[model samples]
Target: MRYGEATVTVVDPRSYMTYQPFLPEAAAGSISPRHVVVPLRRVLPKAEVLTGRVTTIDQDRKVATIAPLVGEAYELPFDYLVIAMGAVSRTFPIPGLAEQGIGMKGIEEAIGLRNHVLEQLDKADSTNDEEVRRKALTFVFVGGGFAGAETIGEVEDMARDAAKYYTNVSREDMRFILVDAADKILPEVGPKLGAYGKEHLESRGVEVYLSTSMDSCVDGHVVLKNGLEVDSSTIVWTAGVKPNPVLSRFGLPLGPRGHVDTQATLQVQGTDYIWAAGDNAQVPDVAARKAGVENAWCPPNAQHALRQARVLGDNVISGMRGFPQKEYAHANKGAVAGLGLHKGVAMIVMGKMKIKLKGRLAWYMHRSYHGFAMPTWNRKIRVFADWTLAVFLKREVVSLGAIETPREEFYEAAKPAPKVAQSAEAQLPPTRAKSEEKAKAS
Candidate 1:
């Protein structure tokens, strides 16, 4: 943008981009919800930020169809297009999963999950019915990846804290189940750390099911392939994610797994004017290639996305200025995940040495790493403050489920009162009745 060679425009369905790494903490009420997102307009004041979704793109005509949140759809023309549209949750046609399963993708879903979990606890505490209490107390999370594991871990911790306030529902009464198709969880960190994470959760009384798949979740009656069936009120689906389906509508060349195929330069294959990155692009890992591996691609993580964005931005500028484009090449920096309050796992690679950390130190590492990685000083400060407060203060156990229907009270209050009509007999005075009686007597 500083080059003044081109007018930049960023089109997205949301006005803000959520930092997904902090979602677990956000869900667990460790951080304020608003601090998790960075407003595009605030960050990029010069770039035109369109609060709408791109429905289709006709590269032949260099025009994309954008449908706003409201009203009719319109076409947007561009000289050069950057497809950083990101990815969506990958789901299958599983019976009852769509109707009953909850997702943990967006900010709204994170907040909703927090509220829903607390609401379930409230239901369990207030109810005497065995079935209702059991269902409310049972929480199932499919996918033992970072999103699934971290969420269940944090929410379970929050629920434990909340149980102290409840006379009826105790921590032992609640059942937290985590199911994964893979043999190990937290594959981002090595197998040993992953095994430890699973063990840690199990020690906390969380049921860890490995190499098992959920057959169905019809009406929240979860049936696993391993012959385990549970009627749960909350079923969180964080299984996995694929490239956004909208990418198919753009008439762009896609990979076998449905991601935009991009060269090392981050530009869409067979097209010079179009560029793609993030979870939607199958970016080549130059480090892997140099390490004598063939066709190795970068994993879909915040670390890769952050680095890719910088290189993509620089390449865009270079393209506009007719300068040589540099390929994105960065070695893996390992992975870190927080499992509730003081429990976490971190694998940091420094040169050839791999450092494995767990417990409180790993938890601090997780916070410090994310706090620095978060975009904008304003957001960074707020996130750091949340961590600081968490050290001094206990986790907030209250749930604002009413926030979803905040206007309900106002709506009820604004309703007009009922009108009552007076009958003619009631309107007559006692004197009129006596006069009528005297006339009759006369």
Candidate 2:
């Protein structure tokens, strides 16, 4: 934000800002989902973005409403508010998971999970129906943290390099699976680097399971609360995240899970012209309560929301120059993930010393620390030119699932224009054309 004093604006519904750890290398096509987002009018050129969707928030009339993205619902009028709406997809009504899961947060769910895992490897390579080719090569990931173990280790390494231009879909006819109720997986990269990222995604075949849980999948069948059963026509759902429940009508003071309860100078606690930080705010982890820890907070990550967004924009410009605010603190600096091309897992931490890395030097320090934490340099030179054109191109592996039905072939070429072939007395039916005109007038 090229901080031009005051007058900011910034509503949202994606004017762009994703950069979500490069959404598993943009679902393993190796980073290109439009360089993983960041536009907001080219990084807030003096703010005022407004894509829209605030839908109500009075706070005793500081006003808010907004809705736009294409029409009515207005209002706005702020003085300082800023909650940072983030988080959703916590899911678990688990019975076909709201019509079959598949979520990765955004960037249109990582380009619809990489065109639905390469259209389930092109329906398991032109299906001959071995149970629809094992339910289109079964995928099924379900959160093991670090977004379901770096998205089933970069979609099982992009379906094992797209089963080498599939003939009948090789890579041992793909499966992947993953599921987790948390017995351990990336546990924030600790426990021996989360058991070396669960033995490097179980040495690439993937299956994992850990403490399991998934009692239903419905139509695509799966079952699992330990009883196991499968079917899987893809499934995904990186299982975690909550906060953005539109902040329950925004009146503020949220906490015990809904978030926005700030204070550690990110304001909001009793409102000081309002303010908040990432993952929808719940602040107060001031260096884990000065290390005594006990009930500490600040963990909805992104490295403590990038240092609570530079101490909530220098405490909203020092509460508009009345000054004195700056509290937010930080203490951990380690955890990289990558798991695909070259594979990964890292840890760095400084003060108490840590350093643990694994494989391809933790995948080149997870792509040079998320390509210098991508966000301008024009999306870090388009994510380092999509990792230098994925080093000599090739891995595109196709499947743009028709970009999710773009007007479905123009609604099947705007059908209904083929009804002009009805001659023969319009297919004869008016009393057989008056009994063939009285047998052609006898």
Whole-model Cα lDDT per candidate? 0.91, 0.84
What's the lDDT for residue 225 in model 2?
Answer: 84
TM-score of 1: 0.94
Q: Which candidate number maximizes lDDT?
A: 1
The residue pairs that clash in candidate 2, if any, are: none
Q: Which stretches of candidate 1 lie over 4 Å from their true place?
A: 1-4, 416-442
Query: Model 2: which ten-residue window has the lowest total lDDT?
Result: 1-10
lDDT of 1 by residue, 70-159 (tens): 999999899889998788888889999888888888999999999999999999888889999999999999999999989998999999
Where does candidate 2 stray beyond 4 Å?
Answer: 1-22, 25-61, 68-71, 76-80, 85-113, 116-156, 159-161, 168-264, 267-271, 279-301, 306-326, 350-352, 360-403, 406-414, 426-436, 440-442
Give me the displacement of residue 80 in model 2, in angstroms.
Answer: 7.2
For each of the candidates, the C-alpha root-mean-square deviation to the true structure, in angstroms, is 3.4, 18.7
Cα distance off (Å), candidate 1, residue 341: 0.8
Report the C-alpha displacement of residue 276, candidate 1, in angstroms: 0.6
* lDDT of each residue in 110-215, candidate 2, tens digit only: 7888888788888777867799888878888888888888878887888788788878888887878898898988888789989888987887788888888898
